[model samples]
Target: MSDPIVPPILPREFGVYFALLEVSALVQHGVEGQLRRDGGLSFVQFQILAILGEDPSSPRSMTDLADRLVHSRSGLTYQVDRLEQAGLVARVPSEQDERGVNVTLTPTGAAVLARVLPGHADEVREVIVDALDGADRDELTRLLRQVARHLRSRPPRSARRAPTRSAEA
Candidate 1:
């Protein structure tokens, strides 16, 4: 096989790609480490727990949870299933929508999150917040949000409707 093309050579700010990779790896490592040591939750699992804990509405529809998680519906269902098996979450039928399922943290999940969150916050602060003073952090957040918004506005190739085939064909 031939070597893949290096990304940095591109004129556009491909720096974001490298930055995304680096930050993702670093954050994943820290969160995974903390979760393994303190709570036995993986990073994605922790994220789900944290989101549910933070939201006032404890139980939410699977589709709603997927949207909140930025995970595809199928992907979120798999994660939620794993969490359910782990005794960290419970999935119930949604009253508001019979077609939807509601996912909620179990008491076990809530207790675990309560125990782990302080240490998790510290790990986040150490790796992210503590690296920058408040002003720089604020500016960084603003700039990053603008970039994210720009990127999000661009539709994926799959999102565009395909041309219809004539019935005669």
Candidate 2:
């Protein structure tokens, strides 16, 4: 057999970039099954529920959800459509804007969220969180926040500090 191919040199920073990509992919893959089995949810669908769960009482506009999710409006709509069909969520007219629609978690949605969150937490701990000590995890979060802020991928207007939730939550 021919000798193994050697890759070209890349900037040192590329290591962090590639690591982030690999870890994200692995973590998502690790949790995908649990989310599906426990909540009958796709990752994006779970994300929608989780976001709404952050403030279940308040409604979030479709546009806001799409932006925050970094997903296309149509894709988000499809996911929302699925959730709505399952009776996990509802779309109501926005009181502030006659034409705008807001998404809210139904009681079923909240119950599903509560049901799945504990297992999700455990899955995350197994796949990623437990790999690091507490300080290291904090550092990782800080670095990611810095990168996110630099990229402006997260818009402040659509971002709110989520309260810390217990595992039971």
* Highest-scoring model, TM-score: 2
lDDT score of residue 84 within candidate 2:
99
For candidate 2, lDDT tens digit of each residue in 53-110? 9999999999889877877787999999999999999999999999999999999999
CA shift at 32, candidate 2, in angstroms?
A: 1.3
Residue 69 local lDDT, model 2: 83
| Candidate with the greatest lDDT versus the true structure | 2
User: Where does the lowest 10-residue lDDT sum fall in candidate 2?
Assistant: 153-162
TM-score of candidate 2 relative to the true fold: 0.83
TM-score of every model versus the real structure: 0.79, 0.83
Q: Candidate 2: which stretches are off by over 4 Å?
A: 1-9, 153-169
Against the reference, the lDDT scores of all candidates come to: 0.81, 0.91
lDDT of 1 by residue, 116-157 (tens): 999999999989999899999999899889987886686533
**Candidate 2 lDDT score at position 111:** 97
Candidate 1 residue 151 Cα shift, in angstroms, is 4.2
Displacement of residue 92 (Cα, Å) in model 2 is 0.1
